[model samples]
Target: MNHGAFRPIELRAPEGSVVDVRDDAPAGAHGEVRKRAVSVALGALSQIIPDLVSGDLCGTSFPNAIGE
Candidate 1:
């Protein structure tokens, strides 16, 4: 991740969640994790500003943005 770009950003996720990684976890999944995080953030924001924020737009399977 570009730590410099998000220098002042602070995130507090629960332990063992997708966003929270343990030392034994495999590496090189940052991009995937980031995408899921974005989806989650947008979903949260939609609750506060439904009209302004887009919903169910993520492409990953984690959130199942588009159901079968």
Candidate 2:
């Protein structure tokens, strides 16, 4: 009756390597990861900050990043 267990994958990349893109490609790739991370963090914060301040956790989640 194990319902919460899961497996993990092992991925390793060497230094100075493009883990996400092809090697030695001229690409504006750094912003995508950061932007996604920030967007997700802000979304989560929006869903939690109201309850954290007002002590009520019944509010629906809202999209904090309007331009996404």
The best candidate in terms of lDDT: 1
lDDT of 1 by residue, 1-68 (tens): 56554335378988766677777775455667787788888788779878776556556645333434
TM-score per candidate: 0.45, 0.33
Candidate 2 TM-score, C-alpha based: 0.33
Q: How many clashes in each candidate?
A: 0, 0
For candidate 2, the 10 contiguous residues with the lowest summed lDDT are 51-60
Candidate 2 global CA lDDT score? 0.49
Per the 3 Å backbone cut-off, how many clashing residue pairs does candidate 2 have? 0
* Top-TM-score candidate index: 1
Candidate 1: where are CA atoms >4 Å away? 1-9, 14-17, 51-68
Q: lDDT per model, in order?
A: 0.68, 0.49
The runs of at least 3 residues in candidate 2 whose Cα sits more than 4 Å from the true structure, single-residue gaps closed, are 1-28, 50-68
Clashing pairs in 2: none
lDDT (tens digit, per residue) of candidate 2 on 1-68: 37645243355656565445565764454555445544655566568774432222333343344442
